[model samples]
Target: LEDEAAYDRIASYSPYDNITAKPYPAILAMGGLSDPRVTYWEPAKWIARLRDVASAGPFLCRINMDAGHGGSSGRYKRLEEVALVQAFAIWAVERSAA
Candidate 1:
């Protein structure tokens, strides 16, 4: 299962539903705003869906920015992403402790 076929197979089955029913140890989602392969919107939608349906909605954090697919040329965008990652990491650690 590669490419679209794999995606189709996965989409046909709602695996996330099963996963969402359980308490998540943690959930972190990161995506590029200008990703050519998979747009940022997809993950944003996913995060919304997860939050709506997942029992552990509070554990999910999504980070995305308007930086073009890789290389990190946009200074402000990269800084924002870096900040988000740092914050999410700290949050995850603290949340797990509690």
Candidate 2:
């Protein structure tokens, strides 16, 4: 964590520090409440920061209450999440065309 250059190189891929004055793309980030790999708050915070810095973007995030990294435990619940993701994609595309 103390390696400044190394951390920068790795984190360069992340929008956290890379987002410029340019308008950001409409991003739809998903998080699972029970996810051990990526806690739900990570995306929530990222969206907030994106809103703060990016010139534009209807940044959106969804946190599944009954899920882990692999997503909801039930098939029906997982399907619902999948549908939501697809819908978000469509909405973003349409919004961009407008």
Candidate 3:
């Protein structure tokens, strides 16, 4: 991504950079409080920006206090987090369709 054209192309993939007047679909942003790869605030910031810029939103932030980037350390807890994400996805899809 060092080359100017290559970097521009790569950067174009970010949703945050492409925000427009919405009726944009719901956004579920999940982040780990202790994530080493993606800090919790990154999602928070994106959601915040969406809320500010988009015309309408059901944008959500789910910050797992007991987990990191990979989610809960325990198997059951991890499953629960997965279920929550799946449920959210379904709900978002349903809302978008309605």
Candidate 4:
């Protein structure tokens, strides 16, 4: 019961519901298209909302078409995902500083 109530209450605080008309830092959202844990639409919809409510943030959504919740199967492939995230973080920082 508490969890259910929390869920209901969270809607008011949700990013989707509480989007402000202010500029925000850039976002890097990545997900797997075939992810069962978190469907691809989750990030896609969030990105759309961010674009609509806040035009200042540069939102980048990367969906791995052939991957699922765990992402790439191999160790090296997983590293690639990490690298991408690192690269994005660096890019965002540099862009913000400039």
Candidate 5:
């Protein structure tokens, strides 16, 4: 699938070694437990990979168990998405100051 290929390519180019390296920009990875196109495992695995490399960037992964796909659905659980975005904004602002 295109998603898997894209992720594979990114992982190939991603620096998964060397801590103390230049800090990457904030990474906000979110997944919906019911999403059929992309599994939650993808983000979780990527987070683990980044941690293994000891990345210096802000990496946050969140999952919405009651949601499906990526959207702002009023009928589904969306608090996690909103919280993640807010947190990312704050994090980016603080990091930019440093």
Candidate 6:
């Protein structure tokens, strides 16, 4: 009985339940296929839900098929992901400005 309230409170904050009609900023939902902690499906599902609910979209999913939750294990490979994020930020800014 005590946990019921907690469950309800937590459920109230769940993204799936709280989708609003308001416009949302561009979202980059990146994940790794081998990720055990934050599985790839989470991002995929989020992107799908956002597409369905949001008024507009620039939602993107970048999944690394060979990596895990921490992303690429090497320095150079990691930079590639970083670059993608930076590029996305720039693109979003340019898009919003225009």
Model 1 agreement with the true structure over 5-95: per-residue lDDT tens digits: 8877777785443445555555666666778876777666766677766666364535455454672556886786778778888987898
Task: Indicate the residue-level lDDT of 70 in model 2.
Answer: 96
For each candidate, the alpha-carbon lDDT, in order, equals 0.65, 0.86, 0.85, 0.87, 0.70, 0.86
Off by over 4 Å in 4: 1-7
Where is the poorest 10-residue window by lDDT in model 3?
15-24
Cα shift from native, residue 59, model 3 (Å)? 0.1
Model 4 misses residue 28 by how many Å?
1.1
For model 4 the local lDDT of residue 74 reads: 86
TM-score per candidate, chains pooled: 0.60, 0.87, 0.82, 0.84, 0.64, 0.87
lDDT of 2 by residue, 1-98 (tens): 99999998989898566766678888988898999999899999888888887877888888988789998767888798889889888998998899
Each candidate: RMSD to true structure? Answer: 4.4, 1.5, 2.1, 2.4, 5.3, 1.9
Q: List model 4 lDDT by residue over 1-98, tens digit each.
A: 56988888988778767878899899987889889998999988889999988878898789999789988768899899889889989998999999
- Candidates 3 and 5, the one with greater lDDT: 3
In angstroms, give how far residue 25 of model 4 lies from its true place.
0.7
Compose the digit string of candidate 5's lDDT tens values, residues 32-58. 888898787877777776765645666
Residue 64 displacement in candidate 1 (angstroms): 4.6
Q: In candidate 6, what are the lDDT values of residues 19-62, reduced to their tens digit?
A: 78778888888999999998889889888888888966688888
Q: By the lDDT metric, which is better: model 1 or model 5?
A: 5
- Which segments of model 5 are wrong by more than 4 Å? 1-22, 75-80
Per-residue error (Å), model 5, residue 50: 0.8
Query: Model 2, stretches more than 4 Å misplaced?
Result: none
The digit string of per-residue lDDT tens for model 3 on 43-92 reads 99889889998955689998999778787878889889889989998988
Rank list by TM-score: 6, 2, 4, 3, 5, 1
